[model samples]
Target: MIEVHQFACLSDNYGYLVHDRASGETVCIDTPDAEACLAAARARGWTITQVWNTHWHPDHAGGNLAVKAATGCTITAPAGDSARIEGIDRTVDGGDTVTIGALTAEVIAVGGHTLGHVAYHLPEAGIAFVGDALFALGCGRMFEGTPEQFWASLARLKALPPETRIHCAHEYTQSNARFAVHADPDNAALAAYAAEVTERRSIGLPTVPMPLDRELACNPFLRADDPALQARWGCGDAVATFAALRAAKDGFR
Candidate 1:
């Protein structure tokens, strides 16, 4: 069986360590904080053998060198953003596949947050480690991609099986819920989800690793293609609706 260790680090970032029990090989999803990641792995008696980077953002890849120095783990990063990233032993594109012991992970091109942003999907494990490209109820800001490009990237994620567990990189669910409710006020599912998020946050809990099916039903960003959202946002197409919703979220608070 495959095990995933999730913990909070660097203010709002959530770090992940994926361990394959049979092989005793561990993969660090990203290096938000090198020390935190190393300690977390140590606590579990797991040694990180690989680091898979989703993007080139500082917070996402900043600790690459340190982690490599400590573990001598091979680093795999997005090919498009390789120029800005450090300690990359291999650069992979959207269709490439990476392995951790016996587990195989498909590298998905989800480049809305950054032109080189990628997601790792282990279909057999039914889990996806999405960096900043996606969130529980929201998505990363359009730092370097266009609406068309971003929407297309989201479509790829949407195509995944509903049962897949979405492991996002941040603890921004509560803040995202506020904007989600405002974006799609009439969605009862969304309203209930927001209330649940509020309750979860009130007790200092993390709201990541959300179910993809729940997100499909409640996340306004994911529902940008739905007729209701398109009509409400006054946009005819998914790309435009996504753009409008993203713009509104930028100024929501």
Candidate 2:
């Protein structure tokens, strides 16, 4: 079986370490804080062997070199963002596959947070390590990709099995819930979800690995194609609605 260890790093980023029990191989899913990641692995008695980067963003890939220096881990990064990323042993794009021990993860192109951003989906494990592309109740800011591109990327994620567990990078759910409620006020599912998020936050709980099905039903960004959201946002299509929502979120607070 494969085991995942999720820990808080930096200020709000969540770091992940994927370990394959049979082969004792471990993979770091983005290096937010090098020391934290290294120490986490050391404490678990697991030696890191690979680093999988999602994008070129400093917070996501900044610690690659240090982690490599500490573990001699092979680094795999997205080809589109390879120019800016460091210590990349292999640069893969969408449709490619990477492995750890016996488990294989499909590299999904989920750009839009950044033009080169990618996500790692381990179908066999029913989980995806999505950087900032898709969040619990929100999506990442449209940093470098077109709205059409972003919506298309989100569509790819939507196509995944509903039961897939989405592991996003940040602890932004509480804030996102507020925006989600404002974005789709009439959604009962979203309202219920927001209430649950509030309760979770009140108790200081982490809400990173959200179920995709719940996100599908509640996240306004993911529901941009729904007719009600299109009408409410005054958009004609998914791309337009997504663009409007992203813009609204940019100025929401």
Candidate 3:
């Protein structure tokens, strides 16, 4: 079993500590703050062995050097962006598999927010560490890729098992829900999820590790193929629905 610990850092960014219970080896996904990750690992009596980066963003990969120096851990990053990411020892692409004790994680290339974005899926543990790709109720902003690429990336994630737990690297569910409601007003699932997310935030709880199927029902971006979204956006196509939803989200605030 892999134990996941969420580290709140750099305002709302999340750094996940994945520990293999059998081996007592810990691997951090997107280390936004190295000190916080170091403290978390030490407190749990787990030896840090690897640092996995989803993208080359400063907020996600900034602490790679610091953590490597402290733990002498190997840094694994996307092959496409290895040149940009510092201290990357092994660069993995889609179809690559990473192992931790008895668990194996598969690599997925889901570039949209960045040119080299990736996600790690641990089938044995039924968890996916998607950096800024698929969020609870929102998708990442298309910074370096086109809408077509972004939609394609999201489709890849949608193909995962419904029971797969999503672990995104941010606490944006509340805001995402609000925007989702605006984009898809008639969606009862969206409205219901928004209310639940509001309560969860009010209680200072992390709204993550959400089931993929639940997000598929409530998240407008994830439900681009739904009839409600298609009708509201005036299109039955996934790409058009995705564009309309993204535009709505951008102007939500």
Candidate 4:
């Protein structure tokens, strides 16, 4: 079994520790806060041996050096943006496979949030750790990439099996849910999910890891191809539809 331990770090950011029982190895995905990540691993009695980063964002990779120094962990990060991330010992891109113990995780290049953003997917484990690439009802803001690049990145994720669990980096689901309902008011699934999110947050719950299938049905960013949304935006091309949705979401509050 792959044991996943999630904890809050640096405001809305989340840190995850994936422990492979078979190999007695542990991998920490992203270092939002070094102390928090190290503490979580200590609490589990697991010594982190590897640190994998999704992008070069400070919030994501800021603690890389600190964590690696503390645990002697090897740091693996995106090759495309390796220069920006501190202390990256191994650089990987899409199509590369990383391992922790007996488990294998495929690295997928998912630019847009950052031109070199990546996601790590363990197909057998049915999990993907996506840092700021895809979020629960929304996608990351276009920072260094264009809408076309981001649209393509999203397609890479959409092609994954619907049952895959998406472990996003931040807790933006509640606000994203509000925008999702606003973008596609007729979506019953989104309305229902919004209600559920409201309840979850009301009791201080986290909604980071959500099923891909649920996002496919209700997330407006993923539903850009829907005829209804296409009609609303008066666009037929998927990229255009996505751009329109992004613009609407940018101004949605």
The lDDT values for all models are: 0.94, 0.95, 0.89, 0.92
lDDT of 3 by residue, 29-130 (tens): 977999988998888887789999999998999999999999999999998778889999999988998888789999999988988899999988999999
lDDT of 1 by residue, 1-253 (tens): 8999999999999999999999999999989999999999999999999999999988899999999999999999999999999999999989999998888999999998999999999999999999999999999999999999999999999999999999999999988999998999999998999998889899988888999999999988889999989999899989999999999999999
Q: What residue pairs are clashing in model 3?
A: none
Ranking by lDDT: 2, 1, 4, 3
Worst 10 residues of 1 by lDDT: 199-208
Select the stronger candidate by TM-score from 3 and 4: 4
Q: Answer with 1 or 3, whichever has the higher TM-score.
A: 1
- What is the C-alpha lDDT profile of model 4 across 19-81, one tens digit per residue? 999888999999999999999999889999999999999999999989988989999999988
- In order, what is each prediction's RMSD in angstroms? 0.6, 0.6, 1.1, 0.8
The alpha-carbon lDDT assigned to residue 175 of candidate 3 equals 90
The superposed Cα distance between candidate 3 and the true structure at residue 249, in angstroms, equals: 1.4
